[model samples]
Target: MTNVSRWAAMLALLFATAAWGGLFHAGKLVLNNVDPFWFTVVRYTGASLLLCGILMLQGKVRWELLREHWRRLASLGLMGYGMFGILVFIGLSYSVPSHGAVIMATMPITTLLMRWVFERQRPQLWAWCVVALAIFGVSLVSGVWRSSTGAGHSTAFGDLIAFVGTVGWIMYTRGQASVSKLSVIEYTTFTAILALPGLFAFAVVATLLGYANRPDPADLIAAIPPILYIVVVGTVLAALAFNKGVRTLGAVHGIVFINLVPVSALLISAAKGSVPNGSEMIGTLLIIVALSIQARKMGLGAKAAK
Candidate 1:
């Protein structure tokens, strides 16, 4: 990539990471007043509708192509949107938002491992070390290594769930690699449509089971602003920007940039009075460094392969 092009790609990646980082704080803000499942239902439902409208406006709607990849699309939807979304919310409920963000810092490492294992394309030794460092860093960030018993057992459980969510996202990204032949809008729309019913079902179950508490009117009103931000900027705009960045930088390089998400979330959380202590900062730094190293290694490997 030329210097200018590379700089543009980096900027795009940074913006995309910031958008995703805001999701942790945004979701936390809404979760204070709304049920997690219901929040996802609303978020994904709105995103799906918005994408559908865009497709219609562009005259690019293709019902037949959706039918052709129905199974893969549904799997992606269920795992990526439905299961991953709901589980992360649950994990957040049990853990700190900053901790969840830090855990997510491991996504690039997880994606690399999955690609290596499933695709049989081994990464460099440094890449493996980076993954190990990220995993350790996540444990520290989650307070799993602070206990006299060697990280409180409950923290371990929460970390495990958060890590699972990270794995789910990595799988989703890998799946996207195979389906990149489709336009981003088309792929996003299909995933959203397939996930819609499940999201609604999850919301319904939460409400019926009394898991959803009614929010105060003020709280509901407060949530509206963040909801709008999430729907418009976080989901729609970020998706578009990420697709453009990937086109310019390629997937491995584009994805490595997501390491910035934890940093953004940490800063946002600190501003919101959820500051992490020195240990947490150290852990976050370790994870970011690990992910960066792993990403660079992967990017180089891709270039060598090409």
Candidate 2:
């Protein structure tokens, strides 16, 4: 890409990550009035339709490729979209948005570990150290140390669930190697469409089982604004911008922008008069520093390899 294009891509990625940072907060608002499964169903209903519309307009549906890879796409969609959404939203009901953001910021390191376990691609010793630092930072951000004191225990628990959700996302990302023939937008649209049935099923089951209550029309109305933000900015726009930026700037360079996720979340929270505590601030800084170091190392290694 040209320098101008690269700069634009980087700017796009910055905004994308910031939008995603705001997602946790927006999701929390919706979850206050809607159950996790229903929220996922609602969000993806709009997102999937819009994405399919985009593909249809572009004449890039690639039905043959989708049919050939139906099973893998469905499985990944279930994990990444269905499972991640339910768990994270449930967790958000108990935790704050900044906490969720910090936990998710660990994704790159977790992806590295997943690579090690699944692909046997061992990371260097320094990489392992970075992982440790990231974990420690997450603990501080989640206030895990305060759990035993009957303070922030639920937040810590929620953070754990959120971390597990992040793993689902990592799996979905890694699983993309199998569907490499499809473009990112194509894969995203297909997986989202495929995931909708499973999301709907879960929502139905939860409502039937009394685990989730059907929201009243008033409740849904109250949630409409945040839900709209989540679908339009968080799901569709961020996903498109992120993929485009990563494609243009290269993964190593693009990954560094993840630092903005937690930062933006905290800033948003602060703006709403929920400033982060000292430990949370410190933990956020540590994770950002570690990820920055890791990204720099990876960028240097990539250049050297070239």
Candidate 3:
């Protein structure tokens, strides 16, 4: 690839990862206004509806094409959005932001492993080492990174939940399996449409069980801006950018960018009045170094990352 295209691809991946970093904070913010399950319902439904509008503009939506891919779409949607969404928000509710952020950085490693196991596509040994370096840095940022799911022990339990969600996320990544015949927008939108009922069902159950409050207009209005930011930037745009990067740079390069997510999330968290702990600062620098080395390996000058 030309340097300009390479740089743009890297930047897109970075932007996508950065957007994901912000979601922890945003999810916490939105949860204050809407309960966990309802937040999922509202968020995905709005995203799906917006995707419908986008599809309409793209021309007559090819409803039939989706039928051929329905099973794959349904499985990915449920695993990726529906189940993973619940785990992450609930995980964050139990853990501190740092725990969630640090745990998320491990996703690249998990994705890499899945790529190897499922696709039988092993990366270079040096690539594995570089990922390990990033993962070690993430563990430092994790600040007592046990993954026990004992609900009473909040941070550890949260780490465990986040870890489980990462596995579900791994399936989502690997189970894309073959080259998609669908365009990016078509793939993202239709899967989301299929995923809606489960989210609504959870919302209903949560409301009925008194675990969630009924969502009123005022509550939705309070959460609208952040919710919109999430559905647009965090979910849709990020997915597009992420897929672009993966296509451009291949999965190994694209996935390692995830190591930087905790640093981005930590910095964003600090902006929200959560001051950085010392380990976070050190871990951030280590991760940057790791990314810089990896970038150089990709023939992007280390200085270019500046």
Candidate 4:
């Protein structure tokens, strides 16, 4: 890529990371008035419709390719959108948003391990050190080093669920690595379509069990802003931006920027009277540094592989 194009890609990646960061706070706000499953159903449904409309408008709809990859796409939808979304939301209910955000920063290390175990790819020693640092950082951020009472309610459980969700995300990314031909819009549309059934199933269960919270008119109105933000900016725009960044700067380069999400989430929360303690900040910094080193090493390995 040319310098200008690379710079633009980097900027897009940064914006995408920021949008993802804001999702922690936005999701927390939305959960105040909606159940996790219902929130996920609405968010994914809205995002699906918006992406479908955009694809139709751009004359880029490809039903044939989607059918060809239907199984993989469906699995991606179920794992990444359906299960991952619901787990993180439920996990957040038990943990601090900042804690969930920081714990998720370990995704890069998880991705590396997945590649090693499943794809038989060995990473460098530096990468292993980075992964160790990331684990320690997450432990610190989650207060796993401290007494149970020192942490908030169910914080440990929440962090564990978040770790599972991170693993699911890594699996989804690995699945997508096999999809070289699909356009971003095509892949997104397929996943969105596949997510609908899973989301609807959860929604139905919630309603049937009377677990669904009926939003008052004001609550309904309150959900509008965050819902729109998530559907439009968080899902569609961020997906496109990240894809573009990966195309220009590569996935490792783009994903290393995601370490910024925790910092951004912390800042947003602090601005809203949810400031993290000094330990959280230190742990966040350590994870960021570790992930950056890990990503750089991964990029070099990819070059060597090529």
Best by TM-score: 2
Residue pair clashes in candidate 4: none
Candidate 1 lDDT over residue span 67-94, tens digit each:
8888888888878777778778778877
For every model shown, what is its TM-score relative to the native structure? 0.86, 0.92, 0.81, 0.89
Q: CA lDDT of each candidate?
A: 0.77, 0.84, 0.75, 0.78
- Candidate 4 local distance difference test against the native: 0.78
Per-residue C-alpha lDDT of model 2 across residues 1-306, encoded as one tens digit per residue: 689998888898898899989999999888888888788898999999999898899975689988999899999998988877888878778789998888878888887787688779999998999999998898898887775565445478888888888777666765666777888788889899999999899989999999888778898899999999999899998877876676677553565677789999999999999988888999999999889888888879977998
lDDT of 2 at 279: 87
**Which parts of model 2 have CA positions greater than 4 angstroms off?**
1-5, 147-154, 248-256
Which one wins by lDDT: 2 or 3? 2
Residue 220 Cα positional deviation in candidate 3, in Å, after optimal superposition: 2.4
Say which candidate scores most in lDDT.
Answer: 2
lDDT of 1 at 286: 93
**Alpha carbon lDDT at 57, candidate 3:** 98
Evaluate candidate 1 by giving its C-alpha RMSD to the native, one decimal. 3.2
> Over the full model, what C-alpha lDDT does candidate 1 score relative to the true structure?
0.77
lDDT of 4 by residue, 1-306 (tens): 689998999898888878888887788788888878888888888888888898899885778888898888888878878777888888887778788778667777777777688779887788888988888888878777666763342367888887787676555555665676887777777887887897888778887898766456677578898888888998789877876776667654666677878988898889999778777788888999998787667668677997
